[model samples]
Target: MLQYLTVPVTAFAQNCSIVWCDQTMDAAIIDPGGDLDRLLVEVKRLHLNLQAIWLTHAHIDHAGGTAELAERLQLPIIGPHPGDQFWIDGLAQQSQMFGFPHADPFTPTRWLQDGDSVQIGQSTLAVRHCPGHTPGHVVFHSAEAQRAFVGDVLFAGGIGRTDFPQGNHQQLLDSIKERLWPMGDATVFIPGHGPESTFGHERRFNPYVGTP
Candidate 1:
């Protein structure tokens, strides 16, 4: 079975998740934005063998700690698609702009795309290229767990701000309706910030994209 724990990190309060397979205790840290010491404490507490780092996008709040974390752990970095290469390259600038700790840019060990799958021990998560908030954003869905880790794409009652470089409002809406809605309304999603919400609840109550 797949298990996870969400820990809010950095001033952005980004929801960094620790997902693992219960059988083997093999785990992956998703979106280690910052506060590395805190994240590692939880990993040690859980006694999980950390294997890799998975990224949803390259925003400073979502990927700031990726480079250092990967280097320290000797772990493979994966995903967020190739479109976020520019964002990854600008980590230092982003950190300065946001008053965050200096973030070093990194190259993913493996770039992901739609239809790809990532594994942790015995569990598998399907990857979806959900761009709009960022040209290379992606989401991870675990059919077995009925959960989706959607970074800054959709919220409980709001949506991602498409005002950054290369952002497109219509494209974001399209990605939500086309890429996310198909995951099934019952699927609970872990967003980049705030509390989690079910797709069904968001579809019915989310003012930005809810049905009338």
Candidate 2:
């Protein structure tokens, strides 16, 4: 079985998740935006073997610590798709703009596509290219666990803002209605910031994209 813990990191309070396969104890950190020391301590406390760094997008609050973490742990940096290359390239500038610590730009070890899958020990997560908040944003879904790490794509009562560079409102909406909704309304999602919510709840109550 797959298990995860959400740790809020950085000034942005981004939800950095530590997901691991219970049977193997192999773990992957999703969106190590910042505060490496704190995240590392949690990893140790949990007695998990850190394996990789998975990204949902290249926004400063979501990917600021990616490069440094990957280098220090010698872990593979994966996902967020190729569309976010420009955002990845501007990590340093983003850090300065957001008043975050200097963030180094990085290249993903493997660029993910919509239909790809990522493995962490005995567990496997399906990758969905969910762009809108950023051109290359993606979400990780664990079917067996019935959970989705949706990054900034969707939220408790709101949806991701499409005001950034390369952001497309229609495309984002489409990704949610098509890629996400199909995952089943009962699935619980972890957003980049704030609390978690179920797709069924969002579909019935979300103001921006709710069916109700």
Candidate 3:
């Protein structure tokens, strides 16, 4: 079985999830944005053996601390696809502009694509390349548990902002309606920020993508 916890980090309160296997205790840290100390504390407290650092996108608030944490732990970094390299390359600038902690860019040890599978202990998560909010954005879904960790691609009662350089308003909607909806209405999604919601709830009420 897979077990997880949402650890909010940074001033943005990005939800950095620590997902692990119940049996082996092997774990992955998903989107460790900024609060390195908090994340480390959680890892130690949980007695988890860090296997990999997973990213959903390269936005500063969602991935600002990835490089540092991964380097310090000597863990492999994975996912977020490869298209968000530009955003990854600008981490230092983002940190300065946003008054974030020192953030440096690092390459993903493995660049995931749509249909990729990520294994944490005995559980596996499917990768969906749901871009638009960011070109390389992806959502990690555990089909067994009907749960997803969707970065900025989605949220409760709202959608990701498309004002950024590579953001596309239309594409974001498509990702939610097309890529995410098929996961099943009961699929609960954990967004980059804020509370969690199911696809069914979002489809019926989310002002941006729900029916009129």
Model 1 lDDT per residue over 1-212, tens place: 89999999999999999999999999999999999999999999999999999999999999999999999999999988999999999999999999999999999999999999999999999999988999999999999999999999998899999999988888889899998989998999999999999998988889988884
Q: Candidates' TM-scores? A: 0.99, 0.99, 0.98
Per-model CA lDDT versus the true structure: 0.95, 0.95, 0.93
For candidate 3, the C-alpha RMSD (Å) to the true structure equals 0.8
Candidate 3, residue 51: CA error in Å?
Answer: 0.5
Question: lDDT of candidate 2?
Answer: 0.95
lDDT string for model 2 (73-139, tens) is 8999998899999999999999999999999998899989998999999999999999888899999
Model 3 residue 135 CA deviation in Å: 0.4
RMSD of each: 0.6, 0.6, 0.8
**Candidate number with the higher TM-score (1 or 3):** 1
